[model samples]
Target: MTGGGWRRTLPLMPASIPSASRENKKKIPYAWELVGWLWLAYFMNQADRQLYSVVQKQVQEALGLTDIQTGLVNTVLIAAMAVMMPIAGFLGDRLSRRRIILWSLLAWSVATMLTGFTGGLVSLIVIRSLATAVGEAFFVPAATALIGQYHVKTRGQALAFYQTAQYFGAVSCGAAGGWIAGQYGWKHSFWLFGGVGVVLVALMWRRLKDAPKTAAAIACSEPIGDVLRALFRTPTALVLTLALGCSTFVNMGCLAWAPTYLQLEPFNLTPARAGFFSMFYYQLFSFAGVLLGGRVSDKIVGRRPAFRVELSGVSLLLCVPTLYLMGATSTLWVVYAMLGAFGFFRGLYDSNIYASLFDVTAPRYHSSATGLMVGFSFAVGSLAPLALGAIKQSYALHTGISLLGVVYIIGSLALFIAARGFFPSDFLRNQQTVPTSPKL
Candidate 1:
């Protein structure tokens, strides 16, 4: 359908649509440039997040912390992010997203540097958890929404490229952080990564620009309550949020503990080796999967939007066995193989996450919906680390990890339902309500 046809179908369509769409079409080069900068920012974001996990043992020994205390550090940070994301999302719609992105980068970079000075659990919670979380929380809703505005046809590919930073950052930090902590102490690792982030902020300040928004766009901004209500009312969005939560739960638990797990008994690997191996194989395969999944989804989604959600569902289903086997196996090689498989499936789902979400949501509410989806997911995910720590005290770490497969089962089922029962109507409504742009 034509753009005018779409606008006519929805009485509430914002008047800013045509001008905004035209501006996006003309700025395609700048859009890719924007992704290039955001890529580096996101790399640092994931790297900072994984730094403590890679050096967990060293930090624990230095601070005299137990397993649960270590777990609480990650839990607190994620919980803080959960609490702040909705507010950030709301602001992203009304405020200048460029400023929000830059300020968030500055705040988090400063927090990361200060994390090196933490003396105990309280200080860690204060700097790493609360301070960093607040900054990081503002980033994604703005960044992703901004990207969505610039690249309509290539949304999956653009986002997939962006998502690769998460894997690369985690892997780099896991390997480098362990070596740094092992040789120079964990404090030095934090200082190094944090400094890089600070420098990056200074460099990106003048380059990034927000999508053009007219007076009508500003006038039509929805309240937080209305945004929340709209997101929850969309069945596909609700299902996608639940799926994200399930995957995040597994990811948080595993990323936080896998390095430590490999250091124990049968593996008996050095901290550096453990960190490298735990992240390397999985993320390597995930890198490949995301690239392939993104290309495939973008090609097919024009004719079959439901296939995007279906792909995510199928990927999660494939992940169940691999996830279980990765935790259950005692053999190092088998564990590595399972990790690779699990990561590949995870990449498939990750590649289309926001692309799929955007399919069912109107353009105006993209940031708010992203915030609601991510906030709820993180809130659900925040319990993983704490729950695993308790399980470690009561049973075994591997046992807890194996049980995460059940979460994936629930998640896959939810996505399948959304794909089969809800996505068709939701996608159709979205296309009808928003100005039709290039196909994703």
Candidate 2:
């Protein structure tokens, strides 16, 4: 494979399988099947994360926890994920990605189930923050890299399809958790989601198989320092990392507070209504944006490789006004409109993020690159919930939320810089590194 054309054959094969069987397997559309299974895992991953935010009020009242303490729960979880991401990325390159993903699903599900048993902040931090974070940190980089191996020509569309699970999970869990809390208790929501995750893990264990490693894959397993150096040397990757951090700051803050915000002010919604409204419009439009963005980018990217990055930059820039308006406005209808617009643009950016990064980095470095980008972004984002919590103490929550538009401005600018000045050279360098042997 090179810059001029896509590969006609699979890039990697299972070592244990014979050449005949490998070719037979390639004829089947198992890539989509992989996407299906991982979609379920990713759905559970997101739904579990959003449950705390959806039921924040109930949890806070039940445990006598203050705003800062509740904010600390999300902050610590992101922090732990950030700390573990690089190690997980390293392992993804060397070990069985299938095993890593399966184990991660099991570990996090168990921790989420145990969360129903927590009595106070300490146990919450231990189960929800540390244990769950450790589990989830292993899933994304490995899963994404695995997908990249399977679908080179349709990478953007496949990832975009996979990405929709995030919006669905957040929206569904937010609404369901709120209703469950109202009907029964916050604890049942946890147990229900966790049990579902465990079932998915068992199914995946039975069905998921690792891609056979190619000689190139085995040969390119560099030391951790080398992997880090390879990624940092690419200017576009660095800018993308910073861009991710900025966007994450806004996203994490909104996810943590938006439901509670709706429940309190001019909106004056019930808990279930607040949770549904907070997620429904934003994610629904976001779902549309990702699919459209993916199909457009895939159609044009062969001729305009940097189009993915450019699309991300443009989408982030477009989202700025809507994000600001969503927070500044008090009218419920206006807020919903802004949320939909903001989410659509966010989906456009999210659709191409990993695809854009993969375009600039060697295939061997995909997991490590994803890990570095995600870890740095999460570290930066971990401050958002805590910062918003502190800001709520001094001013209206909307004020803090409105100010997040500034971070988007900075991120969009960085992405524009990356697209224009650095992407061409970095992309060419990556294309040169990809092994062209037919056996691969």
Candidate 3:
């Protein structure tokens, strides 16, 4: 071009750098504004989920529930998560996540607030369980997918930090819920927790815009059938779905029955004391484990991505044993110690879950990929908690907890197989003795 033509356009661009350079330097703005909202939203998500376990006594007394009836309260919530997650997944991949998340936070928070006024199991079933679950379900798919999109190279570390809010909110919610329920009653605690969420929802409404520009941007206006077809066509997506489902089964089963076990065991603690002790130990450890795992995996993946994921497998392997041993042990010190270890490993597994998914799926597929993974994981795993509750009402804690190991092992195995199939060198490079070649 002529010098005059170039000179005229030069004013539009930065004189020091080319247009290409500017585009590269233009930050995506994902982490600072977007991921922050997502992280906090997830934190509140878990805080509400866990607050119930800590305030079980006040809720039970207020409603006059029996053991099975109390068990139904938890089952209702899990069932909501299980049933709603798939539909949430489809919506996340098809609709604007910003809207889905905002509505979700609002719906759940409102339900939680209403839960404070419940007079019976029926109210608990509708408000706390079903409505709350439906709200909670949409956020994770939207939020987690956003995290993966924003923090490409640092997906594990970023998600771990975001997820830490969950542990923080969970652990903090327990301590706070205990105090609130102690002071005002369980009803007040739910009101307080739900109120904070409602305020955050308004804030999210302001900050969160529709990022309809991600994977779903392709057919931004297409029919639902095309999106569904795209999801099933991915091989890595299918494997991840099964792996996560198996992992969640163990988590739900233990979460539901463990408290009842602790309350009745040689430990023989009251519901309130048991609440403080169990949530304190496990969530605290889970907090530490997740933080540590994220950092460790980040370090490991710098040299090798596959190695980082396989390192996460060690957490599950350790978790199964530690959880079982914790339940078996009678001493408070021993129980706490083992519980801490279990939490650490559990964090390790969770920290790497979507990071592993990111490693296999390309960046464009982040939402739909996680949608598939989250859908099957929660849906399939939802059965475990209900089953465990029934078992606790029928059989020994030993039997129920012991059975959970089977599911945990299966999760580890599915991941192990996937790792072996594609990245066998990772485990060998890692501490595990996994072979260097795929058998097939």
The top-ranked prediction according to TM-score is: 2
Q: Write the per-residue lDDT of candidate 1 for residues 148-200, one digit (tens) a residue.
A: 87777778999998999999999999889999988999999999999999999
> Backbone collision count in every prediction?
0, 2, 0
Candidate 3 per-residue lDDT, tens place, 1-440, comes to 11221111100111221234444665654354577788788888888987777776567777788766776777778767867776676667557778888989988888889989888889888888888988898888777876654454566788888877877777677667777877778899899989999999888787776543422232134455765565555454465677678778777667655555667758887655666676678878887888888888777665554654466566677778776776566777887787677777888888887777665554345566676677677777667756766776698666777667667777676666665564432222222311122121
Backbone clashes counted, model 2: 2
Candidate 1 minimal-lDDT segment of 10 residues: 1-10
Q: Which pairs of residues collide in candidate 3?
A: none
How do the residues 245-331 of candidate 2 rate in per-residue lDDT, one tens digit apiece?
A: 999889999888999889977889998999889999999999999999999999888777788999999999998899788889989
* Candidate 2 clashing pairs, residues 3+ apart or interchain: 13-212, 14-212
Error of 3 at 414 (Å): 1.4
Instruction: Report lDDT (Cα) of residue 353, candidate 3.
Output: 79
Give the Cα error of residue 247 in candidate 2, in Å. 1.1
lDDT of each: 0.86, 0.87, 0.69
